[model samples]
Target: MINADARWLRQARSRLRDADPVLARLIDDRPDFDPRAWMAQLPPMDLFGALLFQVAGQQLSVPATRRTLARIEELFDGRLPSAAELLNVEAGQLRAAGLSWRKVGTLRELAERIADGRIDPDGLSRLPDDEVIAELTAIPGIGPWTVQGALLIALRREDVVLPGDLALRKAVKAAYQLDHLPAEPEVLAIAEKWRPYRSLATSYLFSAAIEFSAAIEPAGAPTDAPLRERSTMAATRAGKGRPR
Candidate 1:
């Protein structure tokens, strides 16, 4: 399995390199980059836990998200709660952990669906990417972006790209020397060359953005307001829960 994965990655890398010169340089520059290395630092989470992470991150900075996640974990003994366990707790408890009422409601609804066999977390991996997105997005507050993050972090799907991600847009701007931040459709059009390796290509762009941010910012200086807004979400998707 490991060999097969390696072979597959090599093929993907070659294909991506041939399809776009920009991505070729990005891939060449980081020959040893492990796209999923950041996952090691996080606690083991199932599909529900992954969704919880994604949902918790919506519209919150990295530090705030981490704090919220920590508070939620403290309620359940320092780990994210399972779908059943989450449903067992009161919604007030989740709110107290810094989750908004909307997030709390979304999570509860998701947990209830899973608990009642309306959605099978385990079966999700067997379905195609679009199917998973469609199934999850049917629940309120669970949009394509949230499901896309789950696809990368939980399912490890190979071809996913988050065109709507602000950090990714910024990354694309910097990497491609665009005059302005590209919209979702523009990002998708640029990413067309990435094809089956969009996920891998995304990892490279995220790494570049993080590196560029660090290079430009001085120590102890506040991040630019716009970039700081979604940096945590991008970083979390990049790897560990911290900034990318």
Candidate 2:
């Protein structure tokens, strides 16, 4: 299997630049951009930490996730708590750390499983993507989107795509000039051309969406909106959760 390391990024960039001209322009627009920069800002995480991060981030805006994670860190000396630490904390404490009760249950159960060897992180890293999805999603409140995030951020899989992510769907629509946000199946179809480099394509599309939003915004507009609010206000105002 191809490792999604620095060398993989170079290859992915070359392939992605060749596969789509519009995306190529987007990449060219930001010559020094690094897709992993955002991930770098996050606290270093193992499979367990990555899974918790994904769970914590579900349906929440990025800023909200950051705040929640920050609170969580404060509870554990500015680090993501290990499974034992998580299990030691009260559920109410976790809820106060910004997780919903549903998420609290999910996280606690996940911790329990991991702590007791019901799920093995090292073994999981060895599983195929489908098996990994199956294993993680068996726990309630954990779903495909969460698994997709872990696959990309934690496992560093080369060709992962998060079609269910609202931001991604929006990015795809805006990038491809589609009339509406592409459904998951359509997103998959469009992404077929980006195979083995879909993760890189996703990064470019996200960047393109940001640039498009900025370019089209009326000059002197308020710039204080948080990214998730700015990018997905319509969905949020409509009371929908931002997809993970």
Best candidate, TM-score-wise? 1
**Candidate 2 accuracy as TM-score:** 0.82
Q: Pairs clashing in candidate 2?
A: none
Model 1 agreement with the true structure over 105-205: per-residue lDDT tens digits: 99999999999999998898899999999999999888888888789878988899887777778789889988887887898999988998899898888
Q: Model 1, 239: alpha-carbon shift in Å?
A: 5.8
lDDT of candidate 2 over 1-244, digit per residue (tens)? 6555767677777888898876787778878767766565557778778778778866565557667888888888988988889999899999998988988998899999999999998899999888999999899878777777778778987787777666666677787888875777898898898887887787777666555553222121111122321222222212233222
lDDT of each: 0.79, 0.71
Would you give me the overall lDDT of model 1? 0.79
Supply candidate 2's per-residue lDDT for 69: 82
Model 2 alpha-carbon miss at residue 204, Å: 1.1
